[model samples]
Target: MSHKIIRSLLEGRLKAWAAARSPALRIAYQNVVFSPAASETYLRAFLLPAGTNSNDLAGAHRLYTGLFQITIVAPAGGGTGAAESLADELAALFPLYDRLTKTGFSVQVMTPVEPGPEQQGDTAFALPVSFQYRADTT
Candidate 1:
């Protein structure tokens, strides 16, 4: 896919998510790990509950309501593929994809790490995500 499309979406989503966090969340990179071209790469991101808000409920509680995990393959550029660029692209594309498909989905990316020695051709990435939803009780 075009890097521009990927970059815009990823940055947009990350920015939106950071704003939602209030204190503002910076991109965390330590959790990132690169696999041999044959294995999969993984990134994990967490969305925590906002500490305070304008509206208050008597019994309101801080709830960890979401999780987004994203795994993507490296582009063919060779030297240090575009992890950040790809992450940003995914961030933006996800919300739109969810909206279009009308599904409850999330995206997450782990921090970057060194590439391992076991890599082979066609590097792979796996982003395993889990989401929870409540049924309409009305």
Candidate 2:
């Protein structure tokens, strides 16, 4: 499968997640999947308020909002496993994170990962995830 499919999936997933919590920003993530041939890669999702300066991306900021990063790697023939893990992580945060951030708050996930997919039953599976969030402050 091409990386574009995965990239689009990740962006849509992240946008839906941010919208649930921060309707004000109306986030639309930009995809940055690298090395299409690589089996594993990192995708970045950025959140910016609507009407944000197109020319001045990053603008000016003194505050150090914590960075949130989630990294998940699935073995060969396990793309579905990776996607599921990402879904769960966002699902857990979409509600509370939005409420907190709407009030001038900021948070970021530091490191997120999990073991390879674990089979529970003939038609079931479980994936692990590790995540971190820190409030942004200047």
Candidate 3:
């Protein structure tokens, strides 16, 4: 239950940010059906929940941690400048120590956003950006 709430809160933030952009970027959410146009730039969001554990012997407190990753997909041969700029914006969106709270649950961004190596395929370049998050419950 807590995991679902955490995911919702985090994903909500990302969705809102994307929607508010000047030229909204299409997003492929987990398990959602989405097909971008051939030359379009978009984003893919993933929530990788590590697991939840009791914070104490009493089991009254719990801790949840996970990695949230977003991949920026751009047209091949378009150069990396656009992808890199988007990565920078995403990193700023979820800065270290940021906190998200809803319905009495709170999640914190535990690390700086990190960008992974770019992967080039026949049709697109995929740049992955990710960060760690932690949530605590009583």
Candidate 4:
């Protein structure tokens, strides 16, 4: 099977998660999933498909581990706190390295990485958090 389906599933879960956060956070990132055509003035949160690693977990079935990157881009001025808050939410949601059981995948690990600026300009500031998820490609 294609890993794209797995990535798609993970992205949907992340957006659902953003919506379920504290009221302020939920509203701050109301449009949690990225829309390429949206205006630049709004805070944008989205997932990037970083690819995956695979291995045979059992006979005839392979376990695929996906590498997903989450980026929270906020306007340059007060975006730092918003970015950090979202990062915290992601970190909390994954909790070290575990599965999303109900969602059908096991998270091998999720960590806040690229501690430096991914992109910076007059209107945006970004933070990237990386995650690994493993699932059977039966």
- Cα lDDT of model 4 by residue, 1-138, tens digit: 445565556555676776565542321332455453232332343344354444555565665654666666666777477678767776776665554543464435444333335677676777776665566554
For each candidate, the alpha-carbon lDDT, in order, equals 0.35, 0.38, 0.93, 0.55
> What global local distance difference test value does model 3 have?
0.93
- Return the lDDT, model 4, position 137: 51
- For model 3, how does the per-residue alpha-carbon lDDT over 105-124 read when each residue is reduced to its tens digit? 89999999999999999999
Please identify model 3 stretches exceeding 4 Å from their true place.
none
Off by over 4 Å in 4: 22-59, 101-116
lDDT of 1 by residue, 1-138 (tens): 122232333446655765565444344332445344333233434432222222336534322222333333443334444455455545444533242111222222322222223223444433333222111110
Candidate 2 weakest ten by summed lDDT: 47-56
Q: Number of clashes in every candidate structure?
A: 24, 3, 0, 2
Better of 1 and 3 by TM-score: 3
Answer with 1 or 3, whichever has the higher lDDT.
3
lDDT assessment of candidate 2: 0.38
The TM-score measured for candidate 2 stands at: 0.28
Q: What is the Cα-based lDDT of residue 8 in candidate 2?
A: 38
Measure candidate 2: CA RMSD. Answer: 14.9
Kindly list the per-residue Cα lDDT of model 2 for residues 16-57, writing each as its tens digit.
Answer: 655564222232134543432234323334332212122334
Candidate 4 has what TM-score? 0.62
lDDT of 2 at 112: 47
Candidate 1 global Cα RMSD: 14.4
